[model samples]
Target: MVNRYLPFFQGVVLNQATPTHHPIPGNGNVAVNFDDEPPLLEELDIDTGLIWRKAVSILHPLRSVDPSLHAEADLSGPALILLSLAFFQLLAGKLHFGIVLGWATAASVFLYFISSMLLSPGRGGRGDLSLYRCASLLGYSIMSMTIFSAVSLFLPRGGGLIFAVGMGFVLWSTRVCSRLLVACSGHGDGHRGIVAYPCFLVFMLFSLLVIF
Candidate 1:
Protein backbone atom coordinates (compact mmCIF):
# COMPACT_ATOMS: atom_id res chain seq x y z
CA MET A 1 0.00 0.00 0.00
CA VAL A 2 2.83 2.42 0.77
CA ASN A 3 4.47 1.83 -2.64
CA ARG A 4 1.18 2.29 -4.46
CA TYR A 5 0.59 5.73 -2.85
CA LEU A 6 4.14 6.99 -3.44
CA PRO A 7 3.38 8.29 -6.96
CA PHE A 8 0.39 10.32 -5.73
CA PHE A 9 2.47 11.86 -2.89
CA GLN A 10 5.25 12.74 -5.33
CA GLY A 11 2.72 14.51 -7.63
CA VAL A 12 1.38 16.61 -4.71
CA VAL A 13 4.92 17.56 -3.62
CA LEU A 14 5.88 18.59 -7.16
CA ASN A 15 2.79 20.79 -7.47
CA GLN A 16 3.58 22.52 -4.20
CA ALA A 17 7.19 23.16 -5.24
CA THR A 18 6.24 24.99 -8.47
CA PRO A 19 5.97 28.78 -8.35
CA THR A 20 2.46 30.29 -8.63
CA HIS A 21 3.56 33.67 -9.92
CA HIS A 22 3.82 34.12 -13.67
CA PRO A 23 4.39 37.06 -16.07
CA ILE A 24 0.91 37.93 -17.26
CA PRO A 25 1.27 40.18 -20.27
CA GLY A 26 -2.31 41.20 -20.85
CA ASN A 27 -4.33 44.38 -20.62
CA GLY A 28 -1.39 46.59 -19.59
CA ASN A 29 -0.42 44.20 -16.83
CA VAL A 30 3.11 42.91 -17.01
CA ALA A 31 5.48 41.19 -14.68
CA VAL A 32 8.18 43.39 -13.23
CA ASN A 33 11.01 42.82 -10.82
CA PHE A 34 10.98 45.68 -8.33
CA ASP A 35 14.67 45.13 -7.52
CA ASP A 36 15.61 45.35 -11.18
CA GLU A 37 14.01 48.74 -11.70
CA PRO A 38 15.99 51.97 -11.71
CA PRO A 39 16.17 54.39 -8.78
CA LEU A 40 13.57 57.10 -8.22
CA LEU A 41 15.97 59.78 -9.48
CA GLU A 42 16.42 57.93 -12.75
CA GLU A 43 12.79 56.88 -13.02
CA LEU A 44 11.61 60.45 -12.55
CA ASP A 45 14.23 61.69 -15.01
CA ILE A 46 15.12 64.66 -12.81
CA ASP A 47 17.29 67.13 -14.70
CA THR A 48 19.90 68.53 -12.37
CA GLY A 49 20.94 71.03 -15.01
CA LEU A 50 17.46 72.50 -15.16
CA ILE A 51 17.43 72.85 -11.37
CA TRP A 52 20.85 74.49 -11.49
CA ARG A 53 19.72 76.83 -14.23
CA LYS A 54 16.70 77.89 -12.18
CA ALA A 55 18.98 78.58 -9.21
CA VAL A 56 21.21 80.64 -11.47
CA SER A 57 18.17 82.60 -12.59
CA ILE A 58 17.21 83.24 -8.98
CA LEU A 59 20.74 84.42 -8.17
CA HIS A 60 20.45 87.34 -10.60
CA PRO A 61 17.45 89.10 -9.13
CA LEU A 62 18.20 92.34 -11.00
CA ARG A 63 18.30 90.60 -14.37
CA SER A 64 15.28 89.45 -16.36
CA VAL A 65 14.07 85.89 -15.82
CA ASP A 66 13.70 83.39 -18.64
CA PRO A 67 10.12 82.43 -19.37
CA SER A 68 11.25 78.93 -20.18
CA LEU A 69 12.03 78.40 -16.50
CA HIS A 70 8.31 78.28 -15.85
CA ALA A 71 7.52 76.17 -18.88
CA GLU A 72 7.95 72.76 -17.24
CA ALA A 73 6.93 73.73 -13.68
CA ASP A 74 9.35 71.35 -12.01
CA LEU A 75 8.99 71.31 -8.21
CA SER A 76 12.03 69.37 -6.99
CA GLY A 77 14.20 72.47 -6.75
CA PRO A 78 11.48 74.43 -5.05
CA ALA A 79 10.86 71.64 -2.55
CA LEU A 80 14.54 71.53 -1.73
CA ILE A 81 14.67 75.28 -1.34
CA LEU A 82 11.75 75.32 1.05
CA LEU A 83 13.23 72.44 3.03
CA SER A 84 16.45 74.36 3.29
CA LEU A 85 14.54 77.36 4.49
CA ALA A 86 12.85 75.27 7.15
CA PHE A 87 16.15 73.71 8.20
CA PHE A 88 17.74 77.09 8.53
CA GLN A 89 14.85 78.19 10.67
CA LEU A 90 15.25 75.07 12.74
CA LEU A 91 18.93 75.81 13.23
CA ALA A 92 18.12 79.32 14.41
CA GLY A 93 16.33 77.83 17.46
CA LYS A 94 12.83 77.85 16.04
CA LEU A 95 10.90 74.67 15.38
CA HIS A 96 8.85 76.26 12.66
CA PHE A 97 9.21 73.58 10.04
CA GLY A 98 5.51 72.84 10.06
CA ILE A 99 4.70 76.52 10.13
CA VAL A 100 7.21 77.30 7.43
CA LEU A 101 5.88 74.60 5.11
CA GLY A 102 2.30 75.47 5.92
CA TRP A 103 2.93 79.11 5.16
CA ALA A 104 4.72 78.19 1.96
CA THR A 105 1.66 76.26 0.84
CA ALA A 106 -0.58 79.18 1.69
CA ALA A 107 1.74 81.57 -0.12
CA SER A 108 1.77 79.36 -3.20
CA VAL A 109 -2.01 79.27 -3.24
CA PHE A 110 -2.21 83.03 -2.75
CA LEU A 111 0.14 83.64 -5.64
CA TYR A 112 -1.66 81.10 -7.79
CA PHE A 113 -4.84 83.08 -7.48
CA ILE A 114 -3.03 86.37 -8.08
CA SER A 115 -0.89 85.19 -10.96
CA SER A 116 -2.90 82.41 -12.63
CA MET A 117 -6.55 82.91 -11.76
CA LEU A 118 -6.46 86.59 -12.60
CA LEU A 119 -4.21 86.22 -15.61
CA SER A 120 -5.12 82.83 -17.08
CA PRO A 121 -7.75 82.93 -19.81
CA GLY A 122 -10.60 80.46 -20.28
CA ARG A 123 -9.02 78.95 -23.39
CA GLY A 124 -5.67 79.12 -25.12
CA GLY A 125 -3.82 82.26 -24.21
CA ARG A 126 -0.28 83.48 -24.58
CA GLY A 127 1.95 82.99 -21.51
CA ASP A 128 -0.65 81.33 -19.36
CA LEU A 129 0.33 80.28 -15.82
CA SER A 130 -0.60 77.05 -14.02
CA LEU A 131 -0.79 76.45 -10.28
CA TYR A 132 2.16 74.04 -10.39
CA ARG A 133 4.19 76.57 -12.32
CA CYS A 134 3.25 79.28 -9.89
CA ALA A 135 4.31 77.10 -6.99
CA SER A 136 7.58 76.23 -8.68
CA LEU A 137 8.36 79.86 -9.46
CA LEU A 138 7.48 80.89 -5.94
CA GLY A 139 9.62 78.09 -4.53
CA TYR A 140 12.63 79.22 -6.50
CA SER A 141 12.03 82.81 -5.46
CA ILE A 142 12.41 81.80 -1.79
CA MET A 143 16.07 81.09 -2.41
CA SER A 144 16.93 84.66 -1.50
CA MET A 145 15.09 84.38 1.79
CA THR A 146 16.83 81.09 2.50
CA ILE A 147 20.14 82.90 2.10
CA PHE A 148 19.00 85.46 4.64
CA SER A 149 17.93 82.71 6.99
CA ALA A 150 21.41 81.18 6.78
CA VAL A 151 23.12 84.51 7.32
CA SER A 152 20.82 85.33 10.20
CA LEU A 153 21.96 82.16 11.92
CA PHE A 154 25.46 83.57 12.35
CA LEU A 155 24.64 87.15 13.36
CA PRO A 156 24.12 88.24 16.97
CA ARG A 157 20.57 88.59 18.10
CA GLY A 158 18.96 92.07 18.57
CA GLY A 159 21.24 93.63 15.95
CA GLY A 160 19.93 95.85 13.16
CA LEU A 161 22.08 94.10 10.57
CA ILE A 162 19.70 91.16 10.56
CA PHE A 163 16.84 93.50 9.81
CA ALA A 164 18.73 95.19 7.01
CA VAL A 165 19.82 91.89 5.50
CA GLY A 166 16.34 90.46 5.80
CA MET A 167 14.83 93.47 4.09
CA GLY A 168 17.39 93.30 1.27
CA PHE A 169 16.72 89.58 0.76
CA VAL A 170 12.97 90.13 0.78
CA LEU A 171 13.39 92.71 -1.97
CA TRP A 172 15.69 90.44 -3.88
CA SER A 173 13.16 87.63 -3.68
CA THR A 174 10.33 89.94 -4.72
CA ARG A 175 12.25 91.23 -7.70
CA VAL A 176 13.00 87.75 -9.00
CA CYS A 177 9.47 86.47 -8.44
CA SER A 178 7.86 89.53 -10.00
CA ARG A 179 10.06 89.40 -13.04
CA LEU A 180 9.33 85.73 -13.58
CA LEU A 181 5.60 86.28 -13.18
CA VAL A 182 5.56 89.14 -15.62
CA ALA A 183 7.73 87.34 -18.12
CA CYS A 184 5.47 84.30 -17.94
CA SER A 185 2.24 86.31 -18.00
CA GLY A 186 2.99 88.10 -21.28
CA HIS A 187 1.65 91.26 -19.64
CA GLY A 188 5.12 92.83 -19.59
CA ASP A 189 6.29 94.96 -16.67
CA GLY A 190 3.16 96.91 -16.03
CA HIS A 191 1.79 94.42 -13.50
CA ARG A 192 5.06 93.72 -11.69
CA GLY A 193 4.18 95.91 -8.74
CA ILE A 194 0.91 94.07 -8.35
CA VAL A 195 2.78 90.80 -8.22
CA ALA A 196 5.78 92.00 -6.26
CA TYR A 197 3.82 93.61 -3.47
CA PRO A 198 2.33 90.37 -2.21
CA CYS A 199 5.65 88.62 -2.72
CA PHE A 200 7.28 91.27 -0.56
CA LEU A 201 4.78 90.66 2.21
CA VAL A 202 5.24 86.91 1.98
CA PHE A 203 9.02 87.10 2.10
CA MET A 204 8.89 89.74 4.78
CA LEU A 205 7.07 87.32 7.03
CA PHE A 206 9.62 84.67 6.17
CA SER A 207 12.37 87.11 7.10
CA LEU A 208 10.74 87.75 10.45
CA LEU A 209 10.59 84.02 10.99
CA VAL A 210 14.31 83.93 10.40
CA ILE A 211 15.10 87.03 12.47
CA PHE A 212 12.93 86.27 15.46
Candidate 2:
Protein backbone atom coordinates (compact mmCIF):
# COMPACT_ATOMS: atom_id res chain seq x y z
CA MET A 1 0.00 0.00 0.00
CA VAL A 2 1.51 3.24 -1.06
CA ASN A 3 1.42 6.17 1.32
CA ARG A 4 -1.46 8.51 0.52
CA TYR A 5 0.61 11.32 1.98
CA LEU A 6 4.06 10.38 0.71
CA PRO A 7 4.18 13.50 -1.41
CA PHE A 8 3.31 15.62 1.59
CA PHE A 9 6.08 14.21 3.80
CA GLN A 10 8.53 14.58 0.92
CA GLY A 11 7.46 18.19 0.56
CA VAL A 12 8.15 18.81 4.23
CA VAL A 13 11.62 17.23 4.10
CA LEU A 14 12.43 18.98 0.86
CA ASN A 15 11.34 22.39 2.12
CA GLN A 16 14.41 22.25 4.38
CA ALA A 17 16.91 21.14 1.71
CA THR A 18 18.13 22.50 -1.60
CA PRO A 19 16.63 21.73 -5.02
CA THR A 20 19.58 19.45 -5.81
CA HIS A 21 18.18 17.11 -3.17
CA HIS A 22 14.63 17.42 -4.45
CA PRO A 23 13.67 13.81 -5.01
CA ILE A 24 14.48 12.42 -1.58
CA PRO A 25 13.02 9.00 -2.24
CA GLY A 26 13.02 6.31 0.41
CA ASN A 27 12.82 2.55 -0.11
CA GLY A 28 9.15 2.71 -1.06
CA ASN A 29 7.34 2.77 2.31
CA VAL A 30 9.88 0.80 4.34
CA ALA A 31 12.23 1.87 7.07
CA VAL A 32 15.69 2.69 5.66
CA ASN A 33 18.49 0.35 6.69
CA PHE A 34 20.43 2.13 9.39
CA ASP A 35 23.69 0.51 8.29
CA ASP A 36 23.60 1.96 4.79
CA GLU A 37 25.16 5.34 5.49
CA PRO A 38 24.02 8.35 3.48
CA PRO A 39 26.34 10.33 1.24
CA LEU A 40 28.84 12.61 3.04
CA LEU A 41 27.26 15.88 1.94
CA GLU A 42 23.62 14.74 2.09
CA GLU A 43 24.27 12.70 5.22
CA LEU A 44 22.87 15.36 7.55
CA ASP A 45 21.10 16.99 4.60
CA ILE A 46 20.94 20.78 4.20
CA ASP A 47 17.65 21.06 6.05
CA THR A 48 18.91 19.19 9.09
CA GLY A 49 22.20 21.09 9.06
CA LEU A 50 20.56 24.52 9.08
CA ILE A 51 18.32 23.41 11.90
CA TRP A 52 21.32 22.12 13.84
CA ARG A 53 23.19 25.38 13.41
CA LYS A 54 20.26 27.55 14.45
CA ALA A 55 19.65 25.44 17.53
CA VAL A 56 23.31 25.62 18.52
CA SER A 57 23.33 29.37 18.04
CA ILE A 58 20.35 29.83 20.32
CA LEU A 59 21.61 27.33 22.89
CA HIS A 60 25.20 28.53 23.27
CA PRO A 61 24.71 31.66 25.37
CA LEU A 62 22.08 30.15 27.69
CA ARG A 63 24.22 27.14 28.51
CA SER A 64 27.16 29.20 29.76
CA VAL A 65 27.34 32.36 31.86
CA ASP A 66 31.08 32.48 31.24
CA PRO A 67 31.74 34.16 27.91
CA SER A 68 34.79 31.96 27.37
CA LEU A 69 32.85 28.72 27.80
CA HIS A 70 31.54 27.36 24.52
CA ALA A 71 27.89 26.83 23.58
CA GLU A 72 28.29 23.03 23.39
CA ALA A 73 28.25 22.54 27.15
CA ASP A 74 24.99 24.44 27.54
CA LEU A 75 23.07 21.86 25.45
CA SER A 76 22.85 19.35 28.26
CA GLY A 77 20.70 19.88 31.36
CA PRO A 78 20.01 23.52 30.65
CA ALA A 79 18.88 22.60 27.17
CA LEU A 80 16.68 19.77 28.29
CA ILE A 81 15.10 21.99 30.89
CA LEU A 82 14.37 24.63 28.29
CA LEU A 83 12.93 22.02 25.97
CA SER A 84 10.70 20.63 28.69
CA LEU A 85 9.53 24.11 29.49
CA ALA A 86 8.75 24.78 25.85
CA PHE A 87 6.64 21.67 25.70
CA PHE A 88 4.87 22.81 28.82
CA GLN A 89 4.23 26.17 27.25
CA LEU A 90 2.83 24.65 24.10
CA LEU A 91 0.62 22.44 26.23
CA ALA A 92 -0.36 25.21 28.60
CA GLY A 93 -3.36 26.74 26.84
CA LYS A 94 -4.80 23.58 25.29
CA LEU A 95 -4.32 20.63 27.67
CA HIS A 96 -6.30 17.69 26.29
CA PHE A 97 -5.80 15.16 23.48
CA GLY A 98 -3.70 17.74 21.78
CA ILE A 99 -1.24 17.64 24.66
CA VAL A 100 -1.36 13.86 24.89
CA LEU A 101 -0.76 13.34 21.19
CA GLY A 102 1.94 16.01 21.18
CA TRP A 103 3.90 14.31 23.95
CA ALA A 104 3.44 10.84 22.45
CA THR A 105 4.68 12.06 19.11
CA ALA A 106 7.65 13.71 20.81
CA ALA A 107 8.54 10.50 22.67
CA SER A 108 8.61 8.53 19.41
CA VAL A 109 10.74 11.24 17.79
CA PHE A 110 13.21 10.94 20.67
CA LEU A 111 13.48 7.24 19.91
CA TYR A 112 14.52 8.10 16.37
CA PHE A 113 17.01 10.74 17.56
CA ILE A 114 18.55 8.35 20.11
CA SER A 115 18.99 5.79 17.36
CA SER A 116 20.76 8.42 15.27
CA MET A 117 22.95 9.53 18.15
CA LEU A 118 24.24 5.98 18.59
CA LEU A 119 24.67 5.59 14.83
CA SER A 120 26.08 9.01 13.85
CA PRO A 121 29.88 9.56 13.94
CA GLY A 122 30.42 13.06 15.32
CA ARG A 123 33.70 14.40 16.72
CA GLY A 124 34.75 16.53 19.73
CA GLY A 125 32.83 17.39 22.95
CA ARG A 126 29.91 18.56 20.83
CA GLY A 127 28.51 15.09 20.31
CA ASP A 128 25.60 15.64 22.64
CA LEU A 129 22.65 13.47 21.60
CA SER A 130 20.40 15.38 23.96
CA LEU A 131 20.36 18.42 21.70
CA TYR A 132 19.57 16.32 18.68
CA ARG A 133 16.90 14.51 20.63
CA CYS A 134 15.36 17.83 21.55
CA ALA A 135 15.44 18.86 17.93
CA SER A 136 13.75 15.65 16.87
CA LEU A 137 11.01 16.18 19.42
CA LEU A 138 10.66 19.78 18.30
CA GLY A 139 10.28 18.67 14.71
CA TYR A 140 7.37 16.42 15.65
CA SER A 141 5.84 19.22 17.68
CA ILE A 142 5.96 21.54 14.69
CA MET A 143 4.51 18.93 12.38
CA SER A 144 1.66 18.19 14.74
CA MET A 145 0.92 21.85 15.28
CA THR A 146 0.93 22.58 11.58
CA ILE A 147 -1.34 19.65 10.91
CA PHE A 148 -3.94 20.58 13.52
CA SER A 149 -3.77 24.22 12.62
CA ALA A 150 -4.48 23.35 9.02
CA VAL A 151 -7.30 21.11 10.09
CA SER A 152 -8.89 23.89 12.07
CA LEU A 153 -8.73 26.25 9.15
CA PHE A 154 -10.09 24.03 6.37
CA LEU A 155 -11.92 21.09 7.89
CA PRO A 156 -15.42 21.23 9.39
CA ARG A 157 -15.89 20.75 13.10
CA GLY A 158 -17.09 17.12 13.09
CA GLY A 159 -15.01 16.28 10.06
CA GLY A 160 -11.92 17.68 11.73
CA LEU A 161 -12.33 15.45 14.75
CA ILE A 162 -12.65 12.37 12.61
CA PHE A 163 -9.69 13.40 10.52
CA ALA A 164 -7.62 13.98 13.62
CA VAL A 165 -8.45 10.51 14.89
CA GLY A 166 -7.48 9.02 11.56
CA MET A 167 -4.26 10.99 11.57
CA GLY A 168 -3.37 9.66 14.99
CA PHE A 169 -3.96 6.09 13.88
CA VAL A 170 -1.84 6.59 10.79
CA LEU A 171 1.03 8.08 12.80
CA TRP A 172 1.01 5.19 15.27
CA SER A 173 0.77 2.69 12.43
CA THR A 174 3.80 4.22 10.72
CA ARG A 175 5.88 3.95 13.87
CA VAL A 176 4.89 0.31 14.30
CA CYS A 177 5.65 -0.40 10.65
CA SER A 178 9.04 1.28 10.95
CA ARG A 179 9.90 -0.80 13.99
CA LEU A 180 8.76 -4.01 12.30
CA LEU A 181 10.84 -3.27 9.22
CA VAL A 182 13.90 -2.69 11.39
CA ALA A 183 13.30 -6.00 13.17
CA CYS A 184 12.84 -8.00 9.96
CA SER A 185 16.16 -6.95 8.36
CA GLY A 186 17.96 -8.42 11.42
CA HIS A 187 20.77 -5.87 11.18
CA GLY A 188 22.57 -7.67 8.24
CA ASP A 189 23.31 -6.99 4.57
CA GLY A 190 23.55 -8.50 1.06
CA HIS A 191 20.10 -9.70 -0.14
CA ARG A 192 18.71 -9.60 3.38
CA GLY A 193 19.76 -5.96 3.66
CA ILE A 194 17.49 -4.79 0.85
CA VAL A 195 14.49 -6.41 2.56
CA ALA A 196 13.77 -3.31 4.66
CA TYR A 197 12.55 -1.35 1.66
CA PRO A 198 9.91 -3.89 0.74
CA CYS A 199 8.91 -4.32 4.35
CA PHE A 200 8.48 -0.57 4.68
CA LEU A 201 6.38 -0.45 1.53
CA VAL A 202 4.16 -3.16 2.93
CA PHE A 203 3.87 -1.22 6.17
CA MET A 204 2.96 1.89 4.24
CA LEU A 205 0.13 -0.01 2.65
CA PHE A 206 -0.93 -1.20 6.07
CA SER A 207 -0.93 2.41 7.20
CA LEU A 208 -3.29 3.39 4.38
CA LEU A 209 -5.65 0.63 5.39
CA VAL A 210 -5.56 1.87 8.98
CA ILE A 211 -6.07 5.44 7.88
CA PHE A 212 -8.99 4.88 5.54
Candidate 3:
Protein backbone atom coordinates (compact mmCIF):
# COMPACT_ATOMS: atom_id res chain seq x y z
CA MET A 1 0.00 0.00 0.00
CA VAL A 2 2.80 2.46 0.85
CA ASN A 3 4.60 1.79 -2.44
CA ARG A 4 1.40 2.28 -4.44
CA TYR A 5 0.68 5.60 -2.64
CA LEU A 6 4.27 6.76 -3.29
CA PRO A 7 3.90 6.16 -7.02
CA PHE A 8 0.62 8.10 -7.08
CA PHE A 9 2.19 11.11 -5.22
CA GLN A 10 5.19 11.12 -7.58
CA GLY A 11 2.88 11.18 -10.62
CA VAL A 12 0.98 14.11 -9.12
CA VAL A 13 4.21 15.96 -8.43
CA LEU A 14 5.44 15.44 -11.97
CA ASN A 15 2.21 16.65 -13.44
CA GLN A 16 2.31 19.77 -11.27
CA ALA A 17 5.93 20.50 -12.17
CA THR A 18 5.20 20.54 -15.92
CA PRO A 19 4.94 24.07 -17.35
CA THR A 20 1.73 25.14 -18.96
CA HIS A 21 1.80 26.87 -22.32
CA HIS A 22 -0.40 29.91 -22.80
CA PRO A 23 -1.63 30.96 -26.24
CA ILE A 24 -0.48 34.33 -27.52
CA PRO A 25 -3.18 36.61 -28.83
CA GLY A 26 -2.89 37.55 -32.47
CA ASN A 27 -5.12 39.43 -34.93
CA GLY A 28 -8.32 38.71 -33.11
CA ASN A 29 -9.09 35.70 -30.97
CA VAL A 30 -6.50 33.66 -32.84
CA ALA A 31 -3.52 32.35 -30.88
CA VAL A 32 0.03 32.36 -32.28
CA ASN A 33 3.13 30.54 -31.01
CA PHE A 34 5.89 32.61 -32.60
CA ASP A 35 8.70 33.30 -30.13
CA ASP A 36 10.05 36.33 -31.96
CA GLU A 37 9.45 38.22 -35.16
CA PRO A 38 11.60 40.57 -37.19
CA PRO A 39 11.35 44.20 -36.21
CA LEU A 40 9.59 46.66 -38.49
CA LEU A 41 11.60 49.13 -40.51
CA GLU A 42 12.06 52.55 -38.97
CA GLU A 43 11.01 55.75 -40.68
CA LEU A 44 13.58 58.40 -41.62
CA ASP A 45 13.51 61.78 -39.90
CA ILE A 46 13.64 64.59 -42.47
CA ASP A 47 14.60 68.20 -41.78
CA THR A 48 14.74 71.38 -43.83
CA GLY A 49 18.39 70.83 -44.77
CA LEU A 50 17.70 67.27 -45.84
CA ILE A 51 14.75 68.51 -47.90
CA TRP A 52 17.07 70.93 -49.69
CA ARG A 53 19.59 68.17 -50.38
CA LYS A 54 16.91 65.83 -51.75
CA ALA A 55 15.59 68.62 -53.96
CA VAL A 56 19.06 69.17 -55.36
CA SER A 57 19.47 65.48 -56.05
CA ILE A 58 16.15 65.31 -57.92
CA LEU A 59 17.17 68.27 -60.04
CA HIS A 60 20.39 66.55 -61.10
CA PRO A 61 19.91 63.19 -62.85
CA LEU A 62 23.58 62.24 -62.63
CA ARG A 63 23.20 62.14 -58.86
CA SER A 64 22.30 58.90 -57.16
CA VAL A 65 18.59 58.12 -57.54
CA ASP A 66 18.53 55.72 -54.65
CA PRO A 67 15.06 55.76 -53.08
CA SER A 68 16.38 54.49 -49.75
CA LEU A 69 18.23 57.77 -49.28
CA HIS A 70 14.91 59.62 -49.34
CA ALA A 71 12.77 57.01 -47.63
CA GLU A 72 11.97 59.42 -44.82
CA ALA A 73 11.34 62.70 -46.65
CA ASP A 74 8.07 64.35 -45.65
CA LEU A 75 5.45 66.75 -47.04
CA SER A 76 7.61 69.78 -46.38
CA GLY A 77 7.97 70.80 -50.01
CA PRO A 78 4.47 72.24 -50.16
CA ALA A 79 5.20 74.38 -47.14
CA LEU A 80 8.41 75.69 -48.66
CA ILE A 81 6.67 76.45 -51.93
CA LEU A 82 3.88 78.23 -50.08
CA LEU A 83 6.39 80.28 -48.16
CA SER A 84 8.10 81.41 -51.34
CA LEU A 85 4.75 82.17 -52.95
CA ALA A 86 3.83 84.22 -49.92
CA PHE A 87 7.05 86.18 -50.18
CA PHE A 88 6.41 86.85 -53.84
CA GLN A 89 2.86 87.90 -53.13
CA LEU A 90 3.97 90.23 -50.39
CA LEU A 91 6.53 91.72 -52.70
CA ALA A 92 3.92 92.27 -55.34
CA GLY A 93 1.53 93.77 -52.73
CA LYS A 94 -1.04 90.97 -53.20
CA LEU A 95 -1.00 89.54 -49.67
CA HIS A 96 -4.63 88.41 -49.78
CA PHE A 97 -4.25 86.36 -52.96
CA GLY A 98 -1.05 84.88 -51.60
CA ILE A 99 -2.73 83.69 -48.44
CA VAL A 100 -5.59 82.10 -50.40
CA LEU A 101 -3.28 80.51 -52.89
CA GLY A 102 -1.09 79.18 -50.09
CA TRP A 103 -4.01 77.30 -48.60
CA ALA A 104 -5.03 76.02 -52.02
CA THR A 105 -1.49 74.87 -52.68
CA ALA A 106 -1.45 72.83 -49.49
CA ALA A 107 -4.72 71.18 -50.43
CA SER A 108 -3.46 70.45 -53.92
CA VAL A 109 -0.32 68.82 -52.59
CA PHE A 110 -2.39 66.57 -50.35
CA LEU A 111 -4.62 65.64 -53.27
CA TYR A 112 -1.61 64.90 -55.39
CA PHE A 113 -0.26 62.59 -52.71
CA ILE A 114 -3.52 60.70 -52.48
CA SER A 115 -3.83 60.49 -56.24
CA SER A 116 -0.30 59.19 -56.65
CA MET A 117 -0.82 56.45 -54.10
CA LEU A 118 -4.06 55.44 -55.75
CA LEU A 119 -2.76 55.64 -59.29
CA SER A 120 0.77 54.31 -58.88
CA PRO A 121 0.73 50.54 -59.42
CA GLY A 122 2.70 48.20 -57.13
CA ARG A 123 2.98 50.89 -54.50
CA GLY A 124 2.52 49.76 -50.87
CA GLY A 125 2.11 46.20 -52.17
CA ARG A 126 5.66 44.93 -51.89
CA GLY A 127 8.63 45.03 -49.54
CA ASP A 128 8.37 47.71 -46.85
CA LEU A 129 7.24 50.45 -49.25
CA SER A 130 4.41 52.72 -48.16
CA LEU A 131 2.27 55.68 -49.16
CA TYR A 132 4.50 57.93 -47.12
CA ARG A 133 7.39 57.00 -49.36
CA CYS A 134 5.31 57.82 -52.42
CA ALA A 135 4.55 61.21 -50.94
CA SER A 136 8.21 61.72 -50.10
CA LEU A 137 9.31 60.95 -53.63
CA LEU A 138 6.73 63.31 -55.08
CA GLY A 139 7.58 66.05 -52.61
CA TYR A 140 11.30 65.85 -53.28
CA SER A 141 10.67 65.70 -57.01
CA ILE A 142 8.84 69.02 -56.80
CA MET A 143 11.61 70.68 -54.81
CA SER A 144 13.46 72.11 -57.80
CA MET A 145 10.24 73.41 -59.29
CA THR A 146 9.40 75.14 -56.04
CA ILE A 147 12.77 76.82 -55.90
CA PHE A 148 12.50 77.79 -59.56
CA SER A 149 9.10 79.32 -58.96
CA ALA A 150 10.47 81.44 -56.15
CA VAL A 151 13.41 82.53 -58.22
CA SER A 152 11.24 83.33 -61.20
CA LEU A 153 9.52 85.99 -59.14
CA PHE A 154 12.73 87.97 -59.20
CA LEU A 155 13.28 87.52 -62.92
CA PRO A 156 11.48 89.64 -65.46
CA ARG A 157 8.31 87.94 -66.69
CA GLY A 158 7.30 87.25 -70.38
CA GLY A 159 10.89 86.77 -71.57
CA GLY A 160 11.87 83.95 -73.95
CA LEU A 161 14.56 82.83 -71.50
CA ILE A 162 11.99 82.47 -68.74
CA PHE A 163 9.70 80.42 -70.97
CA ALA A 164 12.59 78.19 -71.99
CA VAL A 165 13.68 77.72 -68.40
CA GLY A 166 10.12 76.88 -67.32
CA MET A 167 9.74 74.30 -70.09
CA GLY A 168 13.12 72.80 -69.32
CA PHE A 169 12.28 72.50 -65.64
CA VAL A 170 8.92 70.89 -66.47
CA LEU A 171 10.54 68.31 -68.73
CA TRP A 172 13.33 67.62 -66.25
CA SER A 173 10.93 67.31 -63.33
CA THR A 174 8.62 64.97 -65.25
CA ARG A 175 11.48 62.65 -66.16
CA VAL A 176 12.98 62.80 -62.66
CA CYS A 177 9.63 62.02 -61.04
CA SER A 178 9.07 59.03 -63.31
CA ARG A 179 12.52 57.68 -62.62
CA LEU A 180 12.19 58.27 -58.90
CA LEU A 181 8.91 56.37 -58.86
CA VAL A 182 10.51 53.47 -60.66
CA ALA A 183 13.50 53.45 -58.35
CA CYS A 184 11.52 53.89 -55.15
CA SER A 185 8.37 51.88 -55.77
CA GLY A 186 9.56 49.33 -58.28
CA HIS A 187 6.95 50.62 -60.70
CA GLY A 188 7.37 49.84 -64.36
CA ASP A 189 7.67 52.45 -67.07
CA GLY A 190 3.97 52.41 -67.82
CA HIS A 191 2.98 53.03 -64.24
CA ARG A 192 5.68 55.62 -63.85
CA GLY A 193 4.33 57.43 -66.87
CA ILE A 194 0.84 57.42 -65.40
CA VAL A 195 2.15 58.72 -62.08
CA ALA A 196 4.34 61.33 -63.72
CA TYR A 197 1.35 62.86 -65.43
CA PRO A 198 0.47 64.69 -62.21
CA CYS A 199 4.00 66.03 -61.97
CA PHE A 200 3.65 67.47 -65.44
CA LEU A 201 0.37 69.08 -64.52
CA VAL A 202 1.82 70.47 -61.31
CA PHE A 203 4.93 71.96 -62.93
CA MET A 204 2.88 73.20 -65.84
CA LEU A 205 0.51 74.96 -63.45
CA PHE A 206 3.49 76.58 -61.74
CA SER A 207 4.89 77.57 -65.08
CA LEU A 208 1.62 79.22 -66.00
CA LEU A 209 1.67 81.13 -62.75
CA VAL A 210 5.22 82.28 -63.44
CA ILE A 211 4.41 83.26 -67.00
CA PHE A 212 1.07 85.04 -66.64
Q: What's model 3's TM-score?
A: 0.56
Query: Which residue pairs of candidate 2 clash?
Result: 1-205, 29-200, 30-200, 30-201, 63-74
Residue 161 lDDT in candidate 2 = 66
TM-score, structure 2 vs. true: 0.25
Compare candidates 2 and 3 on lDDT and give the better one.
Answer: 3
Which stretches of model 3 miss by more than 4 angstroms? 1-49, 61-64, 92-134
Q: Residues 1-212, candidate 3, lDDT per residue (tens digit)?
A: 34665897978888899756445556564545455543332223436576666666676645646566676646665455556655664564545456435534553566356455644554542333455555556556655566566667777776888788888878776777666666555555566666667668766775666556
Q: Write the per-residue lDDT of candidate 2 for residues 1-212, one digit (tens) a residue.
A: 44666988877766778543233377454554556887765653334444444344333222311211222222233233334434543443333344434543454454445434432334111333344443333333232233333334344445446456545534433343233223322321232233334333432332232223
RMSD after CA superposition, every candidate: 5.2, 24.5, 14.3
Q: Say which candidate scores most in TM-score.
A: 1
> Which segments of candidate 1 are over 4 A away from where they belong?
1-39, 117-127
Candidate 2, overall lDDT? 0.37
The total of clashing pairs for model 3 equals: 0
Rank all candidate structures by their lDDT, best first, as comma-separated numbers: 1, 3, 2
The residue-level lDDT of candidate 2 at 201 comes to 42
Local distance difference test scores for all models: 0.81, 0.37, 0.61
